[model samples]
Structures are given as structure tokens and as C-alpha cells.
Target chain A: MQQTRSIEMGTGLFVLLGMAALFFLTTQTTGSNSLSGSDTFEVTARFDNVGSLKNRAPVRMSGVTIGRVTSVRFDPDTLVAEVKLEIESQYDRIPEDSDAGILTSGLLGSQYIGLQAGGSDLSLQEGSEIEFTQSAIVIENLISKYLFKQDSGSDEK
Target chain B: MLRELYFSFVDFLRTFGALQLFFLRLLANSPAILVRRFGLVVQQVYNAGALSLVIIMICGFFVGGVLGLQGYANLAKFNAEDSVGTFAAFSLLKELGPVITALLFSGRAGTALASEIGLMKATEQLSAMEMMAVDPLRRILVPRFLGGVISMPLLTAIFSVIGLFGAHLVAVDLLGVDPGAFWQQMRSSLEIGDVWEGIIKSMVFGVVASLLAVWEGYNAIPTAEGVGRATTRTVVITAIAVLILDFMITAIAI
Candidate 1:
């Protein structure tokens, strides 16, 4: 009977501990991006090339994540990508004229949108598009361009 | 020869069809299975899950450490050593945790469950209980079945948790991989959907393993050799079932 009681107690601990581990993992992974309890507002940005920008990518302002990229769609007429961002309710003070730029974490890390605050008294409105946007800087393109320039210059010489 | 092959195929299908009905019967009678069974179920949980903790943890830790080491070696070649955490975590959470835990379970708990019930049948305990107006299916089988099924996912989760720590210990402490990058990449890459897939796989494997073990034991011939064969079949069949189920779930989920 004593052994059975202990076993039952151990099983309870096993379940509780598993729940704790799961809680820790989910919180750690989602961080502030959980979208639970926090209201979010949407804003769109247009870019020449969004390049590998995925849904749920973080949107940062001054190194702090204020939102996440919700969708990426190609604009057939403009020949650009329309990236929609969902900003947290707390970050409603972002200026109307601020620019959004796609940036890598390190040299080769995954891309995120970084918001550069502009000088304006009016705050950005939901559903309005941020006109000024910079696309992903493709390292391959830069490297190939440099190599092509080097080859042509040598040929001329 | 062709007629013999056709008969054998039909025999296999018949056995499979009966097993399917047995599984459905167990699941369909959930209400009767639940009443007065919680305590027994809990005891089964202790027997099956709590007892299995040590093996799961030890295996999880070593598997994690190996993943960390191998991932580091491979990622270092591309000057991308920081991504080791992401690699190890993803590997464990997505595949290793469920499949390996289920396989180990089929060996340890699966064999134990089969033998216990098979021996009971061999001794006419189930028949005696049936003669006493007690339903052995509800009283005996349900609790043990529930125990095995409930224990599996918890065991898998424990394996994953220990494995992550093992990976961290190897990648960050011993190998000198940047702790921030290791954790950061892991935090960023692992999503709810990926974890959900692992859990679902373990649950399905649990159902497959437990049901097969119980069914084999219940149907075993009433003799020492027959009980032994049933016990052996439990492990072998559970292992195959787990692997096949894992493949199906992965294909559908992916």
C-alpha cells in the first residue's frame, strides 16, 4: 500500500513536471509574439523584393520587436511585394512617415522588418501602407555584381 | 500455390478485421471503463509511466548529447556553429522523441504488460473473474490499456526535455558554441505546430502499442508456451506498429 501510494505520487509529479516543461518551451519560443491577450493593429508596407520574408517574422523598432509580419503578397501591377505587419497595441505611437526595412539578424540569419521612426507628430494608422520600404539585400546579387564588374574591368584593361 | 497465397491473404485480413473490432469495442465502452477505474488507472500510470522515467531520461540525455555533437561538427564546416541548438531541438521535437520513446516502451512496458495479462489468462484468473459476474474487460484490461496509453506522451515529453538539456550541455558548455545564438535560434525556429506533431505521433503510437499488447494477451492460448509466445508477439508487433504509425503520421502531418 505504501509503495502504491508513492508510485501514485510519483506519477502526479511526472504529469506536473511535463506540463511545466511544455509551458517553459512555449513561452520561450513565442516570447512576446504569442498574440494572446494583447490586441494588435495591422499596417502594410510595399517593397521591391521581400525575399524570403515569411509569415510570423518579427517586426522590430529600435531593436525591440513591436509586431510580426502577417502576410506577404505580390502586387502584379506594381511588381513589388506587399508585406502586412500586425503591431502590438502598445506600440501605437509609431510615426506615420517611418520607413520599414527588411534586415538580417547577423550576416546570414533569418530576415525581419525593422522600423525606422521618422519625424512626424501624427501616428501611423491601421490599414494604411508605409510607402517608403527597402527590400531584402541579396548577398548573392551583390557578390555576382562585384564579380561581373571585376571581369569587365579586366577585359577593358 | 496461388490458392494458398490467396487464402493466407484472406486469413491476414480476417485477423486484422477482428482486431479492429476489438479496438473499437474498448474505445466505445468509455463510460463503463471510466467509473471506479480512476484509481486503478492511476496505479497503472505509476507502474507504466513513473517506472519508465529513468530509462527515458537517460536515453534522452545521451541522444541529445549525440545530436549536439554531430550537429556541431556538421554546422561548423559551414561556419554556422550557432545553429546547433536549432538542429538538435528540431530533431528531437520533430522525430527522435516520439519514435525512440515508443520503441523503448514497446520493449520494456509493452513486454511487461503482455506477460502480466498473458500469465493471468494462463492461470484462469480472467475466467474466474468472469465467473464471479465481474467484467474482466472493464476491470482488468481498461486500466492497463489506459495506463500504457497515458504513459507514452509523458515519457516522450520527458525524453525531449532531457534531450534538450543534454544538447545544451554539450553544445554550449563543452563545445564552446555561443550560448545566445544556440538558444536564440532554437527559440525562433521551434513553433507550436512542430511540437503538436510530435505529441500526436506519440499518442497514436501509445494507442497502437497498448491495444496490440492487450489484444494479444487476451487471445493467447491457455498454456506456458502460448503465454510466452504472446508476450514476445506483443513486443515485436508493437515495435512494427509504432514504426508504421510514425511513418503514416509523419506523411500526413508533413
Candidate 2:
């Protein structure tokens, strides 16, 4: 009887632990910790290239995410990729003349737009375009450029 | 040839009727059994759940690690190694975790349920209960049935969590994927609906497998040879049923 009781208690504890673990997995893996609405203002930035920047990529300021890329498109007139960013409403202090650079976290990690605050008195508004933008750095392009330069120098030598 | 076809059809129908009769009786006895034999049911749960934990957790952790390692290798080819967590989570939560856990449960517990009950029948213990004016289905089958049915989903959920942790160890600690990126991508990619689907599938598999095990045991011939055959049949039939149900559930889910 005591053995049965102990096993019964163990079973209950086991189940509770399983439930807790499952809840942890569901929340952690799904990453939807936000309770507040996804309320944000949309803005645009143009770059010479987006370099495989997927839609729904993060927009960050000083490594903290402030927005997300809603869409990516090509403007034929400018011959550049235009990306629409949806910035959180709370981050309304970004200056109008601020720069948005397509940056990566670490080498080979996902590409994101890193925003730098500028010294302008005017802040960006909904649908505002940040003219100063940088494109994603393509490692293949850099590697090929270095290889070509090295070959040419060797031929001269 | 026509005679043989007719005989085979008859045999199939006979088996089907027997199965339906067993299921109906089990259902009829279920509510009464739960109320009257609550402690027995609890003891059955302890036997099944507590005993099964070690195997389930071990499988979850190793399977998760393998998934993480393999996912990293494939994602690394595209330099998208950070997405390993999302891949592992989807693979485990949506399909592998529940299905594998059910299969394992059938192999471990289903065989045991069959043999335990079958041996009792062979030894006339169940018949003796019938002589004493007790329904063996209420006395014996119900508690074990409830034990297996209840254990299934909890085991599957545990398997998934442990597997994810194992993947984390391999992906973040060993293969050098960014821990934040791995988790962030996984969280953003998954939703409540996916987890719910997994839970529902595992629960269904659990009930079906448990029923098959108990029914096979209850109907076994009163002999040692019959008991052995029922145990084997319990595992084989439960496994096939689980796979078929999984496919049907996936089709409807997607």
C-alpha cells in the first residue's frame, strides 16, 4: 500500500513535470512572448542590393529588435531593392536623417537592418523613406573580388 | 476461387463483429469502472507511467540530438545554420515526437498489458472473477486501459521537450549555431495550433493502441501458447494502427 502510494505520487509528479516541459517548449520554440498587439508604422528604405535579405527579417537598433521587414521589392527607376520596414510605434524617436544598414549578427548569421540615429531634429514618420541605406554584404562577392585581385597581382609579379 | 473469396469475406466480417462487441462492452463498462475502481486505476497508472519514463526520456534526448546535428549540417550548406532550432521543433512537434512515442509505448507497455492479462485468463483468474459475480472487463481491463490511454499523451509531450533540449545541446554547444537565433527562429515559426495537433494525435494513438492491447489480451485462448501469441499481436497490431492513424490525422490536419 505504501509502495502504491509512492508510485502514485511519482506518477503525478511525472505528469506535472511533463506538462511544465511541454509548456516551456511551446512558448520558447514558438517565440511569441508578445502580449501587446503588433502595432507598428510602416517605413521604407532603398539599397543598391538587399543580398538575399528574406522578408520578415528583423530590424534592429543597437542589437535590440525594433521592427521587421514587411516586404522587399525592386524599384526599376532607381535600379535598387526597396524594403518596407514596420517599426514599433514606441520607437518614434528615430531621426529623419538616420541611416539604415543591412547588417548581420555574426559571420554567416541571418541578415537584418541596423538603424543608426542621426543628429536631425525631425523624426521619421509613417511611410517615411530613409535615403541613407546600405545593402547586405555578400561574402561570395568579396571572396571572388579578392581571388581575382590576387591572380592579377601574381601575373604582374 | 469464388468459394474461397466468400469464406475469406465471412472470416473478415466475423473478426470485425468480435472487435466491435469487445469495444462496445469496454465502453459500456468504462464509466462504472472509473467510479468503482478508482484506486486500482491509479495503481495501474503508476505501473504504466512511472515505469515508462526512463525509456521515453532517453529516446527523446538522443533523437533530438540527432535531429539537431543533421539539421545543422543541411542548413549550414545554405549558411542558414541558425534555423536549426526551427527545423528540429517542426520535425519533432508536428510528427516524429508523437508517432515515435506511441510506437515505443506499444512495444513496451502494450506487450506487457497483453501478457499480464492473457496469463491471468490462461490461469482462470479472470474466469474465477466471473464465477464470483464480477465482470472481468470492469475489474481488470478498465484500469489498465485507462492507464495506457492517459500515459500516451503525457509521454509524447515529455518526449518532445527532452528532444528539443537534446537538440539544443548539439546545435548550440557542439555545432556552433547561435543559441538566440536558434530559439528565436523556432518560437517565431511555431504556433499553438501545431502543438495542439500533436497533442490530439498522440491522445488518439494512445487510446487506439491501448484498446487493441486490452482487447487482444481479454480474448486470448486459455493457453500459454495463446498468451504468447496475444502479446506479439498486441505490439504488431498497435504499431500498424498507430502509423495508419498518424497518416489519416496528418492528411486532415494539413
Candidate 3:
């Protein structure tokens, strides 16, 4: 009887420890910005090329994430990529004329949207589109352009 | 030679058939054990889970530390040392946590369960119960199997948590990476899907490891040598099964 009682106590503690670990993982580690949260507003931007920008990529202002790219889709009519962003409600003061640029982290890291706020009193609201946008810099394009410019310069010389 | 080969193939099929029948019997008997002999299951859980916690925690810490050291070295070449946290967290949560925990569990608890039941068979304790008309399958095997399945995912979860802590100790404390970026990048980049993949893998591994251990023991030849062989086979087969299953699950989940 005593042995069984101790076993029960040990089992209960082990189970509790496992539960606590799981709770920490779910609450602490992953992106908990559930889509169902009403504390965010969505906006759109268009780019000539999105490069490697993926859905859920961070939207940063001055290196601090304010939202995430919710979707990236091609617009056949515009011949561009339309990006949907969901910004936290707390960061609703972003100016209406801000610029959205797809930028990479470090030299070879994943790409995210970098937002440069404009000098305007009007704030961006739900469904508003940012007017000025920069597409991701394709490395191949840069290399080819550099080579072509050098060839032209050499020919002139 | 052909006759011998044919006999071996038939033996393999017979063993496979028996294993399938054994699993079905265990599943059939599980409900009764859950309701009536629940305390037995709890006792097995204590035996399998609490007893193995210390070793699992220690191994998790070391594996995480190694990952941090290696990740820092490789990422620093690219001037991306700051992303080591994200790297370590992904590897640990997605692959190492469930796979390594299952491997260790197979070695630790699987061997114990196999040998214990095999020795019982060797000593005729199982036969004694059979003579008394108590179904040993219901009275013995189902509780242990259930306990293992219940304990495995919990153990994997604890292992991952401790592992992340170990990585923090190395990456942030020793390596001088910014603490805020270390956690922030990991939080923002890690989706719920990666965590779910680990959970699902651990749950599946738990069932496979437990079932293999019990089946090996139950069918031992009721001798000392046979019991020893069963224990060895339990560890060997469980390790191979866990790796193959890990690859299959990762391919599907990814």
C-alpha cells in the first residue's frame, strides 16, 4: 500500500512537470499572434518583385517588428505582386504616405518588409495602400547589371 | 539450401503474424485496464517516466549545448551569429527533441519492460497467472503499453524545454549574442506548425516503442537465454523503427 502511494505521488509529479513544459512551449516560443485577434488592422502594398518574401514574414519599422506579411499574391492586371500586411493595433500611427520595401536580414538571411514612415499627419487605416514601395533586390540582376556596366565602361575607354 | 531459405521465410511470416495478433489483443484489452486497473497504469507511468527523467534532462542539455557551439561557429562565418538561437530552437523542436527522446526511451524503459516481462515468463509467473485463469494480457501488458504511450510525449516536451534552456546558456551567456534578438527572432519565426510536428512524432514514437517492448517480452521462449536475447532485440529494433518513422513523418509533415 505504501509503495503504491509513493508511486502515485511520483507519477502525479511527473505528469505535472510534463504539462508545465508543454505550457511553456505553447505560450513562450512560437508566434502567438493568432489571426482571430481583433487587435490588428490589414493594409496592402504592391511590388514589381517580392523575391523570397514569404507569408508571415515580419514587417519592421526601424528594425522593430510591427506586423507580419499575411499574404503575397500576383496581380495579373497590375503585373506586380500584391502583399497584404496585418499590423498590430498599437502601431496604428503609421503615416499614410509611408514606403514599404522588401529587405533581407544580414547578407544572406530571410527577407522581410521594412516600413519607412512618411512625414504626414494622416495615419494608415485598414484597407489603405502604401503608395511608395521598393521590390526585393535580386542578386542575379545586380551581378548582371554590374558586369554589363563594366563592359560598357571598357568599350568607352 | 532452397529448403532452408523457404523455411526461414515461413518463420519470418509466422513471427510477423504473431506480432500483429499480439498488438490487436493489447488494443482489445486496453479499455478494461483503463477503467478497472487504472492504478496499475499509473504505477507503470511512474516506473517509466519519473525514473527516466534525470537522464533525459542531462542528455537534452548536452545536445543543446553542442548545437549552440556548432551553430555559433558556422553562423559566425556568415556574420549571422545572432541567428544561432533561431537555428538551435528549430533543430531541437523539430528533429532532435522527439527523435532523441524516443531513442533514449527505447534504451532506458524499453529494455527494463522487456527484461522484466521476459524474466516473469522464464520463472513461470505468467503461466501461474494463466493457471489461475487471470488473463495476463489484460492484467499485465496493456497497462505498461498505455503508460509508455502516455509518458513519451510528456517526456519529449520536457526534453525540448530543458534543451532550449541549455542553448540559451551557451548562445546568450557565453557567446555574447544579444539576448533580446536571440529570443525575439525565434519567437517571430517559429510557427505553431513546427511544434505540432514534434508533438505528433513523439506520440507516434511512444506507441511504437511501447508496443515493441511488450511484444518482445510476452513472446520470449521462457528461458534465461531467451529473456536476454529479447531485451537486446527490444533496443535494436526500437532504435531502427524510431529512425525510419522519424524520416517518414518528417517527409509527410514538411
Candidate 4:
């Protein structure tokens, strides 16, 4: 009976330790490690297709995560995804002319916002709206459109 | 040909009826069975969770390392090697972690549950329990069922954490990914829903494994050789169930 009790205690302790490890690792993995000195700034980009662009999706420049998408919504009038991004203050010197494009990392991969900075003396301020954002190019849609275009051209011929 | 078809149909119906009867018995006495078989639950918890830790840790380490390596290789083709953590987290939490852990547990614990109970049946222990005015389902099956239900999720949690850490070590230490950047990518990519889906899958797997084990064990014929057959069937069925359930859960969660 004592042996059984000790084994039970050991199992309980092991499970508790495993739970603690899980919690600690989860916190460490998911905790934001961005530069603490930077103030938070918001930027908005509108796109036609947000293709797998999830909330809190990374906003990357040169393959480095600089911010995250705070929200993604549809503008019923424009039929576009209005994506709001929260960027760090230190990297806020993005030029007003900088273009944001929805880029696929690979074939059948996730979509992300890739920002290409333009050479401009003027910097974009907080709450600035990026006007020249390109939506994700859906591969299947592109293929269908190409095939349909060929069919139409043949009829015209 | 028609006669053979009729015979096959009859056999299938017979098997189905037997399975239905087993489930009926399980549902009828679930609560009472659970209460009476608490000790067995504790024993199973110890066996499945504690004794299995070493194998789980080893599997976790290899799984993490391989994920990191493969993720890095694929991302490297596009110079996106920095996104390894995001890949690792999404893969581990969304699919690999729960499925692999449950598969391992099913092979180890599920098979054991079937054989232990099957042997008991073969040895006339179940009949003895019945003769002594005890329900075999309550005395034996309940404890194993409860053990499985409790142990699986806990083991899955352990597997997920260990696998993530293993991936981290490979990505950061061996592959030379900046630890800070790796974690930042993970943070920005993963969501609460991903973790919740993994835990939910673990629980479902637990229930599926335990049910399959009990179903196989309780139906075993009273022969020493029948015990081994039940054990093998229990493992195969439980493993397949885990895989099929994983796909269903993934479709819903995604």
C-alpha cells in the first residue's frame, strides 16, 4: 500500500511538472520579443484578396517580422480586405511611397504582407493609410482566367 | 454467389450487433463502473503516463529536430529560413504533435489495455467476477477506460511541449537561427485556437483508444490464444481510429 501511494505521488508530481513545463514553454514561445523601446503605430492597407492572411499575421520586410496584422475586415462597398497593422515605432520611418503587396512564401504556402521601402525623404506617420497595396494573386483564379481568355480569343479569331 | 452474399451480410450484422451490445453495456453502467474502478484508473494513469515518459521524450526530441530541419530546408529554398519557428509551431500544434503522441499511446497503452482485459477474460476472471455478483465491465473495463481518458491529454500536452523545445533547440542551437527572432516569429504566427484544437484532439483520441480497447477486450473468447489476437486488433483499430479522427478534427479546426 505504501509503495502504491508513493507511485501515485510520483505520478502526480510528474504530471504537475509536465504541466508547468508546458506552460513555461508556451509562454516563452508565444511571448512577444520585439524591441521594447519602440512605440506602437498603426497602418492600414487595403487588398482584394487576403488569402490566408490571419489576424496577428506577421508584417515582414526583408523577411524580418516588423509588425503584425491587428485586424482584417471586408469593405462591402469596395469589396476589399481592409487590413490594419501594428508596427513598431523604431521601424516607423517607412516612406509614404513604399508599396505593400500580398506575397505567397511558396507554392501552397501562407500569404503575408511584404513591404518594399521606396527612396523618399518624407516618412509615413502613424495611422497612415497605404494606398498602393496589391492583393494576393490567386493561382487557381489566374489559371481559369487565362484559359477563359484563350477561349474568348479563339472565338474572336 | 447470392447465398455467399447473404451469409456475409449476416456475419456483418452479427458483428454489428455485438458491438452495439458492448456500447450499450458501457453506457448503462458508465458512472457506477467509473466510481467502482477508480483504483484501476490510477494504475493505468501510472502505466500510460509515467512509464511512457521516456519514450515520449525521445520521440518528441526527434520529431522536433526533424520538423526544424525540414522546415528550414523548405523555407531556405525561398530565403525564408527565419520563419522556422512559425512553421514548427503550426505543424506541431495543428497536426503532428497530437497525432504522433496519440499514435504512440495507442500502440503502447491501448494494446496493453486490450491484452490485460483479454487475458483476464481468457482465464475466466470475468466469469468469476460475474459469479461473485460483480459486473466485469464495472470491475475491469471502467478503470482502463478512465485511465485512458485521463492519461492521453496529459501525455499529449507533454509531447507538444517537448517537441516544441526540441524544435527550438535544433532551430536555434544547431541551425544558428537567432533565438529572439525565432520566438518572435512563433508569437506573431500562432494563435490560441491552434493550442485549443490540439488539446481537443488529444481528448478525442483518448476516448477513441479506450473505447476500442474495451470493445476488443470484452468480446474476446475464453482462450489463451484469443487474448493475443484481441491485443493486435485493438492496436490496429485504435491506431486507424486515431488517424481518421485526426483528419476529421483537422478539417473542422482548419
TM-score of each: 0.93, 0.73, 0.90, 0.72
- After superposition, the stretches of candidate 4 with alpha carbons farther than 4 Å from their true spots are A21-28, A31-157, B2-6, B13-21, B24-28, B32-37
DockQ-wise, the better of 3 and 4 is: 3
Q: Which stretches of model 2 miss by more than 4 angstroms?
A: A36-157
State the local distance difference test value for candidate 4: 0.81
Model 1, position B187: C-alpha lDDT score? 77
For model 4, residues B202-254, the per-residue Cα lDDT tens digits are 88988888888888888777687788888888888878889999988889876
DockQ of each: 0.52, 0.46, 0.70, 0.29
TM-score of chain A of 2: 0.75
RMSD of 1: 2.2
Clashing pairs in 2: A29-B186, A29-B187, A30-B187, A31-B187
The digit string of per-residue lDDT tens for model 3 on B1-254 reads: 99999999999999989888888988888888999999989989998899999999999999999888998999999888888888988999889999999999989999999999999999988899999999888888999999999999999999999999898899889998888988987886788888889999999999999999999999887888999999999999999999999999999987
TM-score for chain A in each prediction: 0.85, 0.75, 0.93, 0.75
Model 1 error, position B237 (Å) = 1.9
> In model 4, what is chain B's TM-score?
0.92
Give the winner by lDDT: 3
Q: Which candidate is the best by DockQ?
A: 3
Q: How far out, in Å, is residue A96 in model 4? A: 18
In candidate 4, list every pair of residues with a backbone clash.
none
CAPRI band of model 4? Answer: acceptable
lDDT of 1 by residue, B15-67 (tens): 99999998888887646666756888888888788888889999999999999
lDDT ranking of the models: 3, 2, 1, 4
Could you list the chain B TM-scores for each candidate?
Answer: 0.97, 0.96, 0.96, 0.92
